[model samples]
Target: MTLIGRTHAREIETLSLDSADTRNALSAALVGELADALTDCAGDAGVRAVVLTHTGSTFCAGADLRDPPHPDALVGLLRQIVTLRKPVLARITGHVRAGGLGLLAACDLAVASTRSDFAFTEVRIGVAPAVISLTVLPRTDPRALARHYLTGARFDAAEAVRTGLLTAAGDDVDAVLEPILDGLRRSSPQGLAETKQLLTAKVLEAFDRDAADLTALSARLFSSPQAREGMTAFLERRDPSWAV
Candidate 1:
């Protein structure tokens, strides 16, 4: 079964995260499939842009605890999105949390419906949003993100845009995306690629400088005693012992 559903229209390719049962979590399989799909998009001349979206109430609920990908793989996936020659945009209409925010930040543009909400939930699971910080820290406002990062508090679409996690938000997600898609369809392929390269230079730089350290941090924390307790509490639907 495919975790990503692909569709193309005009000059854009839409990749929908389709594992609604897992809230489209970043399992190793899902990450591999998405990377492969993006590579195909990069090589296809007919595809001028890529839209990353989801098919459920939650866009992505972070990494799949049952089958999480390696920290290195996640970092590579995030870097791939940032470095993909074709522009990648995110279209969200639901909740996004933890590692999902990394994917959003990696995209060139992201828009969502007002109904969507976001959070960096790794703290609740006794893990840092470490590897993802490679993409996230570069795109977001540090002052605003500090609170969310520490508390794992939920914020709305408007707040996401203000913090630089999303480009725009409205009551109607598709309506908000139409003009943006039209603009991408109108732009020359070479123009878009070069412009995207300019925009992502600093983000790529962050990946080069910090990805290894962050990936190590992520692996360490996830394997720690605190994370074990936290994950157990989460799976049991109870507050972690340290929650107090």
Candidate 2:
């Protein structure tokens, strides 16, 4: 079965992460499919806005540890979302973690349910949020990032908004998102595209300059003994040996 599903209505295309069994983890297959969908939406004149969302309680649990890291694919997919001619909106209804925050940051706008939670969990797994920091660091509050990135603590949707990770959060996601989508639909495609470029120029430049270095850092960390033990401990439902 396909890991990503697409639906369209009123010039808005919704790309749903369908891998609920994996909590919509960013497996290589899922990332590839999402990139393809975004590319299709970018070229479709009927599509004016794209909504990135999921079907399960966990929006995305981050990268799948069962497989090797796909930093290039993840970076490419984020680039596609950021550069797509259409404005992309993240419709978050559940928890987000680690690499998933990268995807969320790449969107032009994001609305999350107040019930949702978020974290930069890489440090706990003995890896740094290297690649994702390219997108996330620009948008998040420096103080908040220093705390969350170092502690791997979970924060609620309201904090996510206050930190600039989310555009808005409320008990009703659709209530918050529909109006933004409506505003986007009213905007001319050229207007949205140009405005998005102006907004994302720094992020795009960071990607161009630091993507390779960050990917290498990620690979090194993931392959380290500490990360191996950390991930193994997580899968086994225990703390890593290094945990004090």
Clashes of each: 0, 0
lDDT of each residue in 1-244, candidate 1, tens digit only: 9999999999899999999999999999999999999999989999999999999899899999999999888988998999999999999999999999999999999999999999999999899999889989999999999999999999999999999999999999999999999998889999999999999999999988988889889889999999999999999999999877
Model 1 has a clash total of 0
Candidate of highest TM-score: 1
Tell me how far the alpha carbon of residue 63 in candidate 1 is from the true structure, in angstroms, after superposition.
0.5
- Tens-digit lDDT track for model 2 on 56-89? 8988999999864489888888888888878999
Q: Local error of candidate 2 at 198, Å?
A: 0.7
Model 2 pairs whose backbones collide: none
Candidate 1 TM-score, C-alpha based:
0.99
List residue ranges in candidate 2 displaced over 4 A. Answer: none
**Model 1 segments more than 4 A misplaced:** none
How high is each candidate's TM-score? 0.99, 0.98
